[model samples]
Target: MDRVVLSFGDSLLRSSDVSLLDPPRWLNDNVIGFAFEFLAASLSPPLSERVAFLSPEVSQFTKCCRDEAAAFLEPLALPCKDLILLPVNDNSGPEAGGSHWSLLAYVRRPPGFLHYDSAPGTNAHHARLMARNLSALLEGDGGFREERAPAQHNGYDCGMYVVCVAEALCEQHLRGCDDLILQSITPQYVTRKRAEWKDVIGELSRKSAVAPQP
Candidate 1:
C-alpha cells in the first residue's frame, strides 16, 4: 500500500544554505549534500510512491509559535499508511541557548533531559517535557503495539533515542502501526544523510510489510 511521509522538521530536513559568516567551514555543503543523497537512494520507486513529504515553513513549526502547526496538522486527513518524522530543533537560534548549533526543530538529543540553559522554564523546555511525556505514554500504551527499529547509536550520544521516541508518539497519535526508522543529523545537515536514512528505512519498510497493521 502507498504511504505519505510527513516530515515536519527543522532546517536539517529543509534545504540548507552555508553560513557565510563562518567561511572555510563548509558545513552546509557537507551536511545537506549527504542528506539528499541518502534520501534519493532510499525513496527509490516502491517506497517513494508510498510516501509524500509535507513540511511547512519555520514559524509554523517553532516551539513558541506552533499554534499554526497544531491547527494545520489537526485537520490533515492523511492515509493510515504514513510515517511521521519529528526532528526537534530545540538547539537552534540564540533563544534556544545554542548560538552555534542548528537543530532539526522537533528532533531531540536525549542527554539526561537537560533544559536550555539560556531560557529556563521557557516554552522550549515545556515542549521537550511534553515530548518526553508523550514518549513515555506511547511506551506504556496497552492498545498500541511496539516494534524495535534499528537504533542509530554513536558512542554515548543518544540523539537517535529522541527520534525513535518521537516516531512512537506520532504513531500512537495517528493510531498507526509502530514501524519507523530513526537517523541522526550531522551538525551540518546534508542531503546524503537522507540516503543513509533511506537505507535504514528500507529495512523497516520490509519489516512493516509483514507486521500487523494497526
Candidate 2:
C-alpha cells in the first residue's frame, strides 16, 4: 500500500481566517497561517506519497469534537509491518495491523482556554508540544518510538525543542520511507514571533507558563 501522510490540526493547521470563541484575530490568524503553509510545503509527494489533511472546518462536525482531534487519528494507525513496508509474517514483520506508514500532524490551541480564558499562553504551550510531537514522528519515522525530547508543555522550551525533534525525526524514521517528507511551512514573521514567544516563555516558564489548565 502507498504510504499515507495525514495532516491533522485545528485552525492553526487547517483554516486561515476561521474564528474560535476568543477574539484578538491577529494572533489566531498568525497561528493558523503558519501551520497551513507548513503542511502545504511538507506534503509535497517526494516528502510523502498520499496526503490527507484533516482540518477544523471538517472537524467541527466530527464526533471527536475539535478539542479531541488526536483521538480522531485512530484510523490512521498502521501496524508495524505496514509502517515498515514489510510483508506481514516475514522475518522482518511487525505486529499485526500495526505497520502502516502514516504521520499525524496535529495543530491546535492548548487544552484549556474554553472555560476560563486563553491567550498566547495556550498557543505557546501547544507550539512547544507540536514541535516535540512532530520531531518525534519525524525522527522515529514509522517506528512510533516514545518521545524523548525535553518538555515544552509550556511555551518556554524555545520552539527549538520542537525543531530539534523534527530534525531528529527527519534523520531517522523519515529515512526509510524514501518518500517520507513532513515539512511544516511557516512564514518568516510567524516563525520569528513563535521563536520570540518561546524565548519569553523560557525566561518565565515557572512564573508565566500557567494558563488556567482545564
Candidate 3:
C-alpha cells in the first residue's frame, strides 16, 4: 500500500489498496474515501448541487465545536445541500483510530439526520455527535434517528456496508425515490463490490494517465 496506484483528485489508493476491498480485511480510509469520490462524481448537476459527501476524517471532525465544524463545512454550502453523506467512525476516545464504521445521512426533505449502522448500536454515539453539531447549520434539523439498514455478517465488512448504503441512497434520490431498498445488498453483494471498485479505479487511472498535465 506504499505505492500510489490511483489518484483521483485528493483520494489516493496505493498499489495494494485493492486488496483491502476483499473480505476479512477492513477497508481503510483510502478505499472508502475513493469510493465516495467516484460516487459523488457520477451525480447529475441539480442532484449534485443538492447533495454532499464527507470523508470519515472530516465527518469525525464534526464532533468538535459547532463553530469549527460549521466553518469547515461552509465551502460545501451545507444550507443548500439536502442530502449530506457522512461516513462515521467509532474511534476510541481521544485516540487516532476507530474499530467500527457507519453512516450519518442528513436529509433536508425531512430536515433531520438518519444514521445507518450495519453493527446496529456501535456507532450511535458518534453519529449523534455529528448531528448535534451540524443540525442547526443544516436548517435546524436536529431530529435524529437510527434507520434500518442492511446488516453485515462480519466485523470487517462494516466499511463496505457504509459504501453500499451511500450508493443505494444516492441512486434512489437520483431516481426521484425516497424509500430505501437495501434488501438486495447481501454479503455476496458486498463482496462483489471489490471487483467493481477495482474496475472503476483501473478506468480512472487510465484516464488520468492519458490526460495531459501541466
Cα RMSD to the true fold for all candidates: 13.7, 17.7, 3.0
Q: What's the true lDDT of residue 194 in model 3?
A: 72
Ten residues in sequence with the least summed lDDT for candidate 3: 205-214
Q: Candidate 3: list runs displaced more than 4 Å.
A: 92-96, 178-180, 210-214
Which parts of model 2 are misplaced by more than 4 Å? 1-33, 50-146, 153-171, 176-214
Pitting candidate 1 against candidate 2, the one with the higher lDDT is 1
lDDT by residue for model 3 (1-214), tens: 1566777877877766777866688888778888888788888887788888887667777875567888777888988887889988888443336888899998888678999999899989888988998875767795999998999998799999999999888877656766645776788999898778878888888877733322
TM-score of each prediction: 0.31, 0.27, 0.91
lDDT of 3: 0.82
> What TM-score does prediction 2 earn?
0.27
Q: Give the per-residue lDDT of model 1 (tens digit) for 80-160.
A: 223323323334331322212111222122112222211222234434533443233122212211223333223212232
State the lDDT at 25 in candidate 2. Answer: 23
